[model samples]
Target: MPRMTTERTKTTVRIDPSTASGEREALEQWLDFHRVTLAQKCEGLDDTQLRTPSAPPSDLNLLGLVRHMAEVERGWFRRVLAGEDAPWIYSTQEDFDRDIHAADVDTYEEAYATWQGEIARARTLAADRHLDDLGLGEHRTGERFNLRWIYLHMIEEYARHNGHADLIRERIDGATGD
Candidate 1:
């Protein structure tokens, strides 16, 4: 919830892994690539454009995706992986998709910073841990997952969301690539 003076910026191009030799290297590189992809999709958009929903019937928007991903990063990495007492980024007990409705410019800035912070923390927490190391889940099922599984899940999640971001971005400004 701390506001950062410097805002998070996205690279127009995503970095490709050239020497990902091991499981950890490959997973991390791919995940980072997807993260960059999502950021790239949202680059150069204004607040109103970002807040525009994916059509009349759907409520999905670029800024909403940004906020939602912030929550997802916090949930999986900070809360679940590191077992920190971190609260939800934007959601609540009453409304799970609250983050998805955030629309203002301030919310956009904050969400991007929060997502980047969570990504950094996740990287730090996973750096020393092996891929096979386990993290306890706080869900009702009481499940446990390995770092490798989390990496894979995150990659998938970002990939899927990046696809949505692509559609939303194109719809917003008719910009399309990659």
Candidate 2:
């Protein structure tokens, strides 16, 4: 599952081939829904509250999750899928979990800005490609994939992270559901 930051938000899941503006529209709706759910976990909190570690040995907070998900979004859509350079947002690739480590974020506004920027780029890529279009770049193992695979993989990531946020929110302040 994709790692989640915090917060839940409104979303509709109905995908009508006729109403789906396009494949990108359907995929982006689910992606946006996941982002909104992550935002819901962080609502009504300050930087200190947002950055507080939720459990022992895990400095995971809603803020960190936002950052991490931003990284994930960029990695899959921009870097891996879209063929762009990674911003190296995290300190270490050896530990992907580091992408979500709780920290003293300067402000909630700034974190959201970072996430929004990445999501926008992802949207652009999804818009420009067809469901059957495999990115020009191949994986390290020389394997290639079509846009259809990317959407499925992303859905898996979001579902996993949303589950994580559910547990973390309950641990932080008994917040859960919707």
Candidate 3:
């Protein structure tokens, strides 16, 4: 699942596809829905509220989730799918989980900007390519993947993270629902 951040204005309500006519359109719509959902989950929260963990003995905060998602978006879209030499925005090789710890307002702002930028680049890259077009995978085996798979994976990622976000948001201030 992707992670989330704190400190966002209320997101515009998602306009779910009424009747997507093709695979690309359907995939894009679903992805966009999940993206908006994540933003909505973090709405009306300050940095401190976002940084509060979901439960004891857990570091899974909303702000950490946002930072983590930024890393995930960059890793998949920019680095792997786009074939760019992009690096992790928050985490490092020595500590891939670094993004999930100790965030502030500035960190939230930077992470949100980076995540949105990556999303824009991913959209642009997808617009120029066919779903069947392949990108080299970043794993040790050097496999390849299609844009379709990436879209599905991102949708799945956001869906899962949004579940966590729901719980965290409810715990934070009694806000809940799809």
- What's the lDDT for all of these models? 0.80, 0.70, 0.79
TM-score against truth, every candidate: 0.89, 0.77, 0.89
Write one digit per residue (lDDT tens) for candidate 1, span 70-177. 888887877777777888878888888988877343566777888889889889988888988887556436777789988999999999999899888888879887
**Which tens-of-lDDT digit does each residue in 1-178 have in candidate 2?**
2233454343424332345466667676776777777777776665666666667787777777787777777777887678777765654767766667644434556667888888888888878788888876665577877788878787778778778777777876787885
Pairs of residues clashing in candidate 3:
3-65, 4-65, 4-66, 5-66
lDDT of 3 by residue, 32-95 (tens): 9998888788778877787779998887988788888887777777777788888777787877
In angstroms, give how far residue 61 of model 3 lies from its true place. Answer: 1.1
Candidate 3 worst ten-residue window by lDDT = 1-10
RMSD of every prediction? 3.8, 5.6, 4.0
Q: Where does candidate 2 stray beyond 4 Å? A: 1-25, 93-96, 105-107, 140-142
Candidate 1 Cα outliers beyond 4 Å, as residue runs: 1-13, 103-106
